[model samples]
Target: MLKMKSTCERCRAALTLSEQAYICSYECTFCPDCTEALSQRCPNCQGDLVLRPPRTRSPTEAPSLGFKAKLEDFLYRA
Candidate 1:
């Protein structure tokens, strides 16, 4: 499963579970703004950026979207 990182690793921008995110093959995550600033490339590996899957909203889903709550409770935890 893809880790729904709570923030953009580059600029520390908040990213919600349902928000669109981009990731390289290496799973280097970034927000669309940072991705554009980097010329739509992954800084770590220069790989193509692709859409990260939106977090499932089902409450019973395994790996529940609890991370979102934690992220909100501590926006700058990372």
Candidate 2:
């Protein structure tokens, strides 16, 4: 269900599930390059960044449509 959290918050790069995106506890998303530059820390929330779980795709959903929808649910739970 974790889809479309792929755009880099810092540079607006078009990131994909295959490319990997880092996200903080507050759901601040960044590309791998930006994450490395920031030392895996989210500047906005000042939290540790980690690899966002790749979104699970539905068989009937178009990939692009699904990718364009940002995720705001089920992302922050211990």
Q: Best-fitting candidate, measured by lDDT? A: 1
Candidate 2 lDDT, 1-78, residue by residue in tens: 444565898999997766688988778889989999999989998899998877555434655344334342334331
State the displacement of the C-alpha of residue 9, model 1, in Å, after optimal TM-score superposition. 1.0
What is the per-residue lDDT of model 1 for residues 23-71, given as tens digits with 9 covering 90 to 100? 9888888999998899888888889988898885633465525777688
- C-alpha positional error of residue 20 in candidate 2 after TM-score superposition, expressed in Å: 0.5
In order of appearance, the predictions have TM-scores of 0.68, 0.64
Candidate 1's TM-score reads: 0.68
* Local lDDT at 14 for model 1: 94
